[model samples]
Target: MALEKYSTVLKMAQEGRYCVPAFNTYNYETIAWAIEVAEEEKRPVIVQLYPGYDFYIPLKVMCDAAKELAAHASVPVCVHLDHSATYEIAFAGLAAGFPSVMIDGSSLSFDENVALTAAVSRAAHALGCEVEAELGHVGSGSNLDDFATGGKFTDPDEAVKFIELTNVDALAVSIGNAHGAYAATPNLQLDLLSKINDAVDIPLVLHGGSDIPDEQIKQAITRGIAKVNIATEYFRAMYKGYSASIAAAPDKDSLFEISQMSKDSVKEFLRGKFNLLKADV
Candidate 1:
């Protein structure tokens, strides 16, 4: 199958009442593992590239690799640019064949965020790509206090207005979730999510999906979270796998063998995630 549009993938997730897993991949191994597991589990997956990783994995390289993988995968797969902090980076991803791009202007003033997101949306849509924008800030996991603060939760009314102004295909909302490994168990604001769902017609997204309770995630999906982003968990899993492989076989001299060990571990981890999200081809 060809690469699917990000909006279309999320729309299916919305209609099916399941949150599609969007995994951040840093290298060829990680990307291959994610796509392989998605195909095996018969689930659609979103392979995303963080702008920071672009320094190591060129935008074009990642896009071309994902396109090639998706082309041959048995399940639907889409390539996305995640947490793109600027219009230039987001545009570069879109131009390089990423069907979905996120312009994260959440740290800016509300008006400024709206303006920037709108600009990116207009440009991306003109090229037949989808735009995702973050409204309230989803902070780092190291700061647990940020999740507890009521101020960080996205206001339903503001979300509705933001979508109206920006014309984005999806909205990433902050509701007691943070990026990276959570310092403690998260208390997701499902009520707040329900209100946001009621106010906005577009698919809703939840970032910082790592380590959140499975039940909490299921509830969020039921409440209208169409996409969940995962990064820390996969990174840790792959690293642990690589480390263990070297420990078990200290004399192994082949780089390809060591890389395969890490990819296998990542694939196993992703299989569980696909099952958790109830992804079925």
Candidate 2:
């Protein structure tokens, strides 16, 4: 497998029982190590970078490293621009060589989201970059109210309409899931997820993959979630690894040694995900 179109990768995944984990990376270490781990596990993976990190690292630099690494890997990798709020941002991502870009208009009215996403889908397709759009609003973990409300969840009928209107490669559904650490254990609306999966033909995405129970994650996969976005947990793995390495080698370790030790943890974390996300069939 090599660097490939995200749409191709995800569409293939939609046919399987497991998802292709999309790991969010803000640094070179994460990207390089992530692909390496994917190679070790022999599983397809998606590498995503949020636009907010552009201030810290240039988008060109990020995309270049991810693409180059994926080109040489033994397993498939898809470079993606995650969560662009507008067309301009989505265009920037495709221009920067991302094979896929997500245009998020979840905060807008249905018609508005349709217009914005449809426009992006048109432009992105022209450039051969696939588009992913969010239907229901996925909110922050701090506000439990975000996931608790029934209206906020994706309506199966509306999901069908949204996909027909936008023609996105994937749909990110809000099903009792939130970003970052959960205020309390969340019971993912698996029933709603099933309805959405039954309603649409495209791959379904589950944001906030972090902190969900393994059984529930498996259930979500069984129900038709093809892409799982894991962010907070991966960052925490890196931090936990590096900090523990430094603490244990206070007198003997250099930055290089600490990073080498840290890769162990990152590798362990990634391996767990790759194994878990491997299709059941």
Candidate 3:
């Protein structure tokens, strides 16, 4: 098996009426765990690297690691750079061999966001890569106030215009979804998502997949969310594994053993998530 393009996997998800689970990975343990679960479930998965992670894990290193892991996986896997806030970082990810990059200009004005996303799209398309653009602001979930005040649902009409102008392979919508762990359970705006879906033909993406109710997420998939990003839950799963391992055996200090334990925990967590998405083997 080889690393498949993000556009291809997303398309499959879109047509299949199910969303693919995209897990954020910063190191070998996380990346390996995601791919291992995807292989076992026989489902296509996207391994995403956030730009902020570059401080600890270099972009090139993560990209190379994802490519290598995906190359030998039994199921299709795609490498993506998530929420790249700048063109330079997005370009660097593409150059580093990521098949997908997100140009996040959601904070900017509509025109500016369109211009920035369009420029990145042109460059990415030229290199046979896919570009994802965010249309509305998906605020941080840690701040419930921000969730109420900062977030704006994507306008169906604007989504049509933005996708037309940017030529993005996927459009990330903010319809009552935020990033990070939710302070409270989210009530997804599936009707709004349906409107956006009706307006645009490209695949739709949902961020802040951690705490949304499973039924809401399933409804979202039915409405056209083809990709869902999960970060906080995966990170929490790894932390729980580490805590349990140290508590059970305080004297155990083998890095390999600890890493394996952590990976196994994350794999089990992902298996449940994959099943939630109705992923098939």
Candidate 4:
């Protein structure tokens, strides 16, 4: 499939009993590994980058990499901006040929959030890009330090209002999810998620999905969670791979071995997710 708006991919997940993995990337090697696994499994995945990551690797390079990966990959890939805090970055992402972009105005007041998100939605749609916006604050980790907020749940009624006002293609609800690796297992607000799901017609996204039990993840997907954001687990695997590589070779570090090890580690996690989601190649 050609590169398309995330709305189409997200809709497919809802109707098909699956959830698309929106994987975060930093370097070219990580992005390459993600695309390789997605292509090998023939699963639709979103390559998501954030504002902080934009400094490490310019947005232009990332989008170009994503475009090239999508253009030639065997399966489907969508390039997206993960947590855009302001309209300027959102507009930059739209102009960079991203197929989807997220506007995270959850830190703002309800009215301001709606207004800013509406503006972003308009700009993104005009460029043929899908827009995803957050309803409630999801805490920070994985370099999302500014996104942190205490345990707050999105009001189902307010979610409906936000959607109506913003006209976003997808909604990312807080629902007790956070940004980084949890110190303990997170208590996912399944009931709250279901209420929001029932309130809105658009696809729902779950952020900070790392460390959640597989059963809970599956339940979220079945109950209308179309997109799941995963970052910490991927970082964990990379750290594990490098640590093992260093332990095995006390003298020298093989860059190739390190890259392949990280790739193998992530592939195992992703393959299981694709299978559980009932994604077919």
Candidate 5:
């Protein structure tokens, strides 16, 4: 399968009944796993890399690796940059041939966020890349401290205006979803999600999806969410694989074992998630 752009996958999600799983990839291991699952399931998927995540590594390696893996697959695999805080990182991802990039200015004021997102949108769009901007600060932490972010919520009215002015390809709203794994059960604000979906024309994204229950996620998708970002669970799987590799053999076993293990774990995870996403060729 060819690597499609984010817009193409998102449009399918919107018209279809479920969302597309956007898995975060930090290295070649996770990327391989994502592509494997996407191919097996024959579903469109988005593989994203966060800012400062293995920043020392070149982006081309990641892109080329994914491109190679995607070449013979049976599904669409789109690469993206997730939670980029600066124009430099965003531009790098675009120049490196990522199909999509997200500028997460949710930490800034409304006006500032709009300004930055607009600039990023222009830059990315000019390069034939899709841009995603976050509105309302989805707290930085996944625990009780998430509440301390002042419960940053996206007002439907503001979301409408922001999308119009920014012209972003997608909108990630902070409807009670935070980053990282939740220490407790998260109470997703479905009402806010409904209002935002009703107001915005583009696809809505749900972050911190790893911790949310199946029912909450299913309801959110039914209400009009097209993208779901997952990270912590995959991270946990990668760590567990490494630990198991060490415990099983103290010798200098090939690191590829750990990499392959992580990939398999994440593949299983994506299979389940895309099932919920109702992935179909």
Candidate 6:
């Protein structure tokens, strides 16, 4: 099938008590490997391209690669634009063939975030793209000690209002989850996540899935988190594969062998993650 709607897979995860693994991709190899493993596991996966890296990689190329790969995949594959900071970028993603786009207005004030999200939601919904909006700031993983730097924890009551006004399909809450690799194990505020879960009807998303203990992730899914974003670790896994391939290569210029090994690495990492979520999917 072609790219599935983000909500279709996420709502399934919410109902089945598992979180959809959203892997951020920057190139064709990454996109191909994501679908390759999802098909092998017979599970759903989200292929996300971060707009923040558009300076280095074109969004259109990423979108084309994912769409081509997902069209023939046996399992559900969602092509998404991850954390589009500006309305223009979200629209750009939509134009590039993203079935889902996330508008990151968490850095703005509540009202400001609402307005920005509402605008993007209106346009995106009309075009049949699911929108994921963030409330409260998900801070950088390196500076976990400073709440001020990462923004405040998402207010449960406010989360309800944000959903109603924006009319988004998913809400990403900041309950101590941050982006990139964590310096240490995170003590996720599952208690706060429960409150947000009770207050909202849409699927909840947890960013920074990398390095979080599996026990906490399972606990969060049991609570209400339906979508979990994993990036840093996946990139690390891909690099690990590339490094190994180079070390075992008979010649230094064996680009084909190195590339194939890198994909093997991606499939290996995904197999473990799929098994973790298999009980539900």
Highest TM-score: give the candidate number. 2
Model 1, global lDDT: 0.88
Pairs with backbone N, CA or C atoms under 3 Å apart (clashes), candidate 3 = none
| Least accurate 10 contiguous residues by lDDT in model 3 | 143-152
Rank order by TM-score, top first? 2, 1, 3, 6, 4, 5
lDDT of 6 by residue, 14-94 (tens): 766666889988887888888888887777899899998888888888888788888888888999999989999999999
Tens-digit lDDT track for model 1 on 145-172? Answer: 7786767779899999999999999999
Indicate the residue-level lDDT of 126 in model 3.
Answer: 98
- Show where candidate 3 strays beyond 4 Å: 149-151, 279-281
The per-prediction tally of clashing pairs is 1, 0, 0, 0, 1, 0
TM-score of each: 0.96, 0.97, 0.96, 0.92, 0.91, 0.94
Instruction: Please identify which of the two predictions, 4 or 6, would achieve the higher lDDT against the true structure.
Output: 6
Scored by Cα lDDT, where does model 6 land?
0.85
What ranges in model 4 sit over 4 Å off? 141-151, 278-281
Model 3 over residues 1-281: C-alpha lDDT tens digits? Answer: 56998888989887776689999988888888888888888889999999888889899999998899899989999999999998998999899888899999998999999999999999999999999899988988887754555347789999999998999999999988899888887888878889999988999999888888888888888888889999999999989988887777778888677766666667789999998985232
How well does candidate 6 match the true structure in TM-score terms?
Answer: 0.94
Candidate 1: segments with Cα more than 4 A from true spot? 279-281
Better of 5 and 6 by TM-score: 6
Decreasing lDDT order of the candidates: 2, 1, 3, 6, 5, 4
Instruction: List lDDT for all candidates, in order.
Output: 0.88, 0.89, 0.88, 0.81, 0.81, 0.85
What is the C-alpha lDDT profile of model 4 across 1-281, one tens digit per residue?
Answer: 84756888888777777899888887777677777888888778888888678777888889888888788877778888889999998988888777788999998999999999999999888877789999888875433332323346788999999999999999998876778876556667778888999989999998998877777788788778888988888777777877877777767667876666556666777776676654232
As a whole number from 0 to 100, the lDDT of residue 126 in candidate 2 is: 90
**Cα deviation of 276 in candidate 1 (Å)?**
1.3
**All models, RMSD in angstroms:** 1.9, 1.2, 1.9, 3.2, 2.5, 2.0
